[model samples]
Target chain A: MTGTSFIFWIVALLTVGSAAGVVFSKNLIYSAIALLFSLLGVAGLYVFLWADFIAVTQILIYVGGILVLIIFGIMLTHRITNVQLSHSSIQRGVGGVIVLVIFAGLSAMILNAPWHRSPAIEPLETVREIGRMLMINYLLPFEVASILLLAALMGAALLSRKTD
Target chain B: MVDLNTYLIIGAILFSLGMFGVITRRNGVAVLMGVELILNAANVNFVAFARFGGMDLTGHVFSLFVIILAAAEAAVALAIILNIFNNLGTVNIDEANQLKQ
Candidate 1:
C-alpha cells in the first residue's frame, strides 16, 4: 500500500475501534476518553482528505471542548461506581443488532451505488474560498447561525443557574 | 474506486457506531457524545463529496457550519445535562422516563 493508503487505513482503524469502545465502555469516563480518540482519528481522516482547517476544528471543538464537557457532566451526575454503570447484555445485544443492520444496509447501498465523479481533485482552495463565499452568498445563514449560538448560550446560562 | 464511496462508507460506519451508542448507553452525556459522532460522520461525507465531486467547496463549507453547530449544540446540551444533574442527581437517561407522562 502507498503511504496515503496506509495512513488512511490506520486512521480508519483507530476511529472505528475507538468508536466501538465508546459504545461498549461501561464507565462514562472511559467512554468519553474513547470518544476523544475517535475524534482524533476523525481529525486524521480530515487531514487525509486535505481539510486542514476542519481537522484542527475537530480537535479544538470536539476533543478540547465537547469531551471535556462530557467528562465533567459524567463526574457531576454519576454518584454510582463505574462498575455499577455496566449495563445488561440485553441492551448491548439489541443495540448491536440494530447498528449492525443499519451498517450492513448502508455499506451495501454505498457499494452498489454508481458514484459519478468530476475530475477536479486538484485540492480546491476550500478553506480560503469558502470563507469568501460565506461572506458573499451564505452571509445571511452565517449571521443567523451566530445568532442561534448566542441564543443557545443565553438559554444554557439561564438553565444552569443555581437558584439560591 | 479510490473516491467518495470509500469515505462515505467510513462515515456510515461511524454514524452507525454513534447510533449504537445512543441506543444502548444509559448516560445522557454519552448519548450526546454519540450525537457528536453522528454529526462528524455527516461532515466526513460532506467533505468527501466536496473533494471528489467538484462541488466547488460548498460541501466543505456546509461541513464547517455543521461543526460550528455541533459545538454550539454540545455546549448547550452539556449545560442542560448539568441542570438536570443539579435537579435529579443522575444522568441515566432511563430515569428520564418520568417525563413520559
Candidate 2:
C-alpha cells in the first residue's frame, strides 16, 4: 500500500472509532471528549480531500466553539462530579437492527453505483478560490449566512436568559 | 490511493451510527450530538463528491454552509435543552412528556 492509503486508513479508523465512542460512551463528558477527537479526525480527512480551508473551519467552529458550549451546558445544568449524566437507551435492540440494515443497504448502493470518475488533480491552494467564490457566485448566500448567524446569536441569547 | 468508494463507505457508516444514536439515546444533549454526527457525515459526502466528480467549488461551498448551519442549529438546540432542564429538572427526553398524558 502507498503511504497515502496508509495514512487514510489510520485517520479513518480514528474518526470512526471516536464517533462510535461519542454515541456509545456512558458518560456525557466522555462522549463530548470523544466528539472532540472525532471532529479532529474529520478535519484530517478534509486535509486528505484537499479542503484545507474547510478543515480549519471544522476545527475552529466545532472543536473550539461548539465543544466549549456543550461543556458549559453540562456544567450549568448538572452537578459537576456527583451527577451520573449517562443516557439510557429506550429501544436499543431495535435501533441496532435498523442501523445495521441501513448500513448494509448504503454500502451496497455506494459500491454498486456507477459514479463518474475524473482524473485526480494535484491539491491546489483553495482558500483564495473559496474567498473569490464567496464574493462572486455565492455572494448572496454568503450574506445570508452572516445574517443567519446574527439572528441565531440573538435568539439563543433571548432563549437562555433568566426570566424575572 | 484510497478509492472514493472507501470514503463513501465511511460516510455511510458514520451517518448510520448517528441515526442510531438519535433513535436510542434519551438525553436531549446526546440527541443533539447525534444530529451533529449526521451533519458531519453529509459533509463528508459533499466533499468526497466534489473531489471525485470533477465539480469545482460547489461541494466545498455547500459543506461550508453545512458547517455554519450546524453551529447555528447546535446553539439553538442547546439553548432549548437548557430551557427544558430549567423547567423540567432533567434532560431526559422520555421524562419531558407533559403533553403525552
Candidate 3:
C-alpha cells in the first residue's frame, strides 16, 4: 500500500510478464523485443533497490548490447523471417507445468525464510568504494573477467566465420 | 513484511521462466535469451541483498560484473547459434540431434 511497495509490485509484474513472454511468445523477434522490456523492468527494480550503478549497467549492457545482439541473431537466422516461428501447444503445456511448480517451490522458500537485515551497517553508496575495491582487493578478478571477455569475443568471431 | 523476500521471489520467478525457456525452446538463440533471463534474475538478487542485508556496495559491484559477463555470454552464444543455423539450415534442437542416434 505504500509508495515503495506499489512501485515494487508494478515493476515486479512487468518483469515477470515480459519474462514469461520471452519464454512463451511464438515470434522470435517479438520475444527479443519482450526481452528488452523485461530487461528494462529489471533495471527499474535495481533503481528501486538503491543500486543506481547496477541499474545503469543493466540498461547499458543488457538493453543496449545484448538485446541488439539477439535481434541481429534473429535477423541473421532464417527461421525468424518466416511467420511460422511459433512453438507447439504441447510444449507450452509442459513448460507451463514445470515452470509453475518451480515458481511455487521457490516462492515458498523465499517467503518462509527468515531474512535478517544487519542493523549496524549504514546505507553505502557503493560506486567509489567499489571502484577502489576493484582497483585494490578485487583487482585480480576484475582483470581476469576482462580477459575472459576478450577471449569470448575472439571465440565468437572464430565460430561465426565462414569456413572454406 | 515487504522486505527482501518479495524481491527474492520475483527473482526466483524470473529465473524459473528462463529455465522453462531453455528447456522448451527449439532455437539456439532463444535458448541464449533464456539464459540471459536467468542471469538477470541472479543480478536482481545480488542487488537486493546488497541494499537490504549487507548494506555494502559489493553486491552491486558484483552485479555489474555479472551484467558484463552476461553480455559476453550472449555474444558468444549467439555466434554459436548462428553457426549452427548456417550449417543445419534450421535452429530446431530436435533437428540437431545427430548425437542421439
Candidate 4:
C-alpha cells in the first residue's frame, strides 16, 4: 500500500473511532472531548482532498469555535455538584438497525454508481479560484450568509439572556 | 485517499453513526453533537465530489456555505437547548415533552 493510502486508513480509523466514542460514551464530557479528535480527523481528510482552505476553516470553526460552545453548553446547564453528567440512551436496538440499513444502502449506491471520471488536473491552489467564485458567481449567497450569521448572533444573545 | 468511493463510504459510516446518536441520545446536547456529525459527513462528500468529479472548486464553495449555515444552526440550536433547560429544568429532551398530554 502507498504511504498516502496508509495515512488515509489511519486518519479514517481515528475519525470513525472517535465518532463512535462521541455516540457511545456514557459521559457527556468524554463525548465532547472525543468530538474534538473526530473533527480534527475530518480536517485531515480535507487536506487529502486538496481543500486546504476548507480544512483550515473546518478546524477553525468546528474545533476552535463550535466545540468550545458545546463544552460550555454542557458545563453551564448541568450542575457539577450533581452526580456525574453521564447521559442516557433510549431505543438503541431500533436506532442501530435503522442506521445499519441506511449505511448499507448508501455504500451500495456509492460503489455501484458509474461516476464520470475526468482526467484529473492537479490544481496547485484553490483558494484564489474559490475566492473569485465567491465574489462573482456566489456574491449573493455570500452576502446572505453574513446576514444569517448576524441574525444568529443576535438571536443567541437574546435567547440566552439572564433576564426573561 | 485516491478513491472517491472510500471517502464517500467513510461519510456514510459517519452519517449512520450520527443518525443512531440522534435517535438514541437523551440529552439535547448529545443530539446536537449527532447533528454536527451528520453535517461533517455531508461536507466530506461535497469535498470528495469536488475533487474527483472535476467540479472546479464549486464543491469547496458550497461546502463553505454549508459550514456557515452549520455555524448558524448550532448557535440557534444551542440557545434553544439552553432555553429548554432553563424553563424545563433539564436538558434531557425526552422529559421536555409538555405537548405529549
Candidate 5:
C-alpha cells in the first residue's frame, strides 16, 4: 500500500529467493553468487529498518570481506581447470522435514506472540550513537572484540600455515 | 508500514533455510555459507527489535558485535577447512571423519 512496504516486499522476496538459490543450487560457484545477492537483499532490509550504518557494514564485511573469503576457499580447495565445481548434498529428506517443523513452530510463535511494541520511530544517528556507546557503555566489549579479532587473525594464520 | 512481525517471519524463513543447508550440505565451505545465512537472520531480528521495541540503538551495537564475531569466526573456520582440504584432499565433512585409521 505504501512505498516502504512495497520496497520491503521486493527486498524480502529477493532475499528469500536468492537464499533458496544458495541452498538448492548444485554448483558451488552459483551458490556463492546467490549468496552475494542474498546479502545485498539483507542490506536492503537494514535500510528499511533505518539502520543505515549497519546496512553499509553488512555490505562491507559480508559481501566485500566474507563472501570473497568464501570464494577463495572454493577456488583453492578445488582443481579449477574445468570449473565443474559440484557441491553435493546429503540427507535431504530428513533435513527438509526437520526444517519444516522448525519453521512451522517459529511461524506460529511469531504470529501468536502478544508482542508489546512501541512505534516511536525516529531517524537515528546510528553511527554517532554507536561510536559513543562503544567508547563508553560498551568499552569492555569493544576492547574484547578487538582482542578477539587479533587472536582470530593469528589463529587463522597458524592454522593455514604450510606443513612443509 | 512494515512491522516487527514481518521481519520476524522473514528471519524465520532465512534461519530455517540456513539450517537446512547446514544439515544437508557435505562440502565444508557450503556449510559455512549456511552459517552466514543463519547469522544474517539473527542480525535482522536484532535490528528489527531494536527499532520497534523502544531499545533505540542497542540492537545496532549488538549486531555490530555479531558482525565482528562472524568475521572472526569465518576467518578461522575457512582456515581450518583449507587445512582439511590440504591434508584430506577433500572438503567433505563425511569423508574427513575417519582420521584415526
Candidate 6:
C-alpha cells in the first residue's frame, strides 16, 4: 500500500470510530466531543481528496461554528454537569435489521456500479477556482444561500427567545 | 492508490450508522447529531465523486452548499429542540407527542 492509501485508512477509521461514539454514547456531552473528532477526521479526508478549500471550510464552518452551536445548545437547555441523557433505544432489533439491509444494498450498488475513473491524477489547486465559480457560475445559488442563512438566523433567534 | 469504491463504501457505512442512530435514539439532540452524520456522508460521496469520476468542481460546490444548509438546519433544529425542552421539560421525541392527542 502507498502512503496515501495508508493515510486514507487511518483517517477513515478515525472518522467511523468517532462517528460510532457519537451514535452510541449515552452522555450527550460525550457524543458532542466524539462529533468533534468525527468532524476533524472528515476534514482530514477532505484534504486527502485534494479539496483544500473545502477542507478549510469544513474545519471553519463545521468545527468552528456548528459544533460550538451544538455544544451551546446542550449547555443552555438543560442541567449541564449532572444531566445523564439516556440514549434509550426504541426499536433496537428492528432498527439494526433495517440499517444492515440498507447498508448491504448501498454497498452492493456502489461496488457494482461502473464508475468512470479518470486516469490523470494531477494535484489540483481548487481554492481559486472554487471561489471564481461561486461568484460566476454559481452566483445565484450563492446569493440564495446567504439569504437562507439570514432567514435561519432570524428564525432561530425568534424561536429560542425567552417568553414571559 | 485508494480506489473510489473505498470512499463510497465509507459513505455508505456512515449513512447506515446515521440511520441507525436516528431510528433508535430518543433524545432530539442525538437524533439531530445523527442527521448531521448523514449529511456528512453525502458530502463525502459528493467530494469523492468530483475527485474520481469527473474533474468538474460542481460536486465540490454542491458539498459547500450542503454544509451551509446543514449549519442552518442545525441551528433551527436545535432552537426548536430548546423550545420543546422549555415547554415539555424533556427532549424525548416519543414523549413530546402533543399533536397525537
Clashing pairs in 6: none
Better of 3 and 6 by DockQ: 6
lDDT per residue (tens digit) for residues A1-164 in model 5? 98877878999999999999999999999999999999999999999888999999999999999999999999999998948799889999999999999999999999999987986667658889989988989999999999999999999999999968
Model 1, B1-101: lDDT tens digits are 35788799889989998998888777788889789889989999988887787667787778888988987898789888887777777767787666787
* Collision pairs in model 5: none
Scored by lDDT, model 2 comes in at 0.90
**lDDT score at residue A64, model 4, on the 0-100 scale:** 91
- The candidate, 2 or 5, that scores higher on DockQ is 5
Which lDDT tens digits does candidate 1 get at residues A60-97?
A: 88888878877777666766455555432238888888
Each candidate's fnat, listed in order, reads 0.74, 0.69, 0.79, 0.81, 0.87, 0.79
- On lDDT, the candidate that comes out on top is 5
Which lDDT tens digits does candidate 2 get at residues B36-93?
A: 8999999999999888888787889999999999999989988999999999999898
Model 5 TM-score, 2 decimals = 0.97
lDDT of 1 at A41: 95
Chain B alone, TM-score, model 4: 0.96
User: What are the per-model DockQ values?
Assistant: 0.70, 0.80, 0.71, 0.86, 0.89, 0.81
Using DockQ as the yardstick, the better of models 1 and 6 is 6
lDDT of 3 by residue, B2-51 (tens): 67877898899899989999888887888888999999999989888887
Q: List the residue pairs that clash in candidate 1.
A: none
lDDT of 4 at A45: 97
Ranking by DockQ: 5, 4, 6, 2, 3, 1
Name the 10 consecutive residues with the lowest summed lDDT in model 3 chain B.
Answer: B51-60
- CAPRI tier of model 4: high
lDDT (Cα) of model 4 = 0.93
TM-score of chain A of each: 0.89, 0.95, 0.87, 0.96, 0.96, 0.93
Please write out the lDDT profile of model 3 over residues A43-67, one tens digit for every residue.
Answer: 9998888777778888888888999
Instruction: Rank candidates by lDDT, best first.
Output: 5, 4, 2, 6, 3, 1
Candidate 2, CAPRI quality class derived from DockQ: high
Candidate 6, A81-162: lDDT as tens digits: 6678555668989999999999999999998999988863645578878888899999999999999999999999999999
Label model 5 with its docking quality class: high
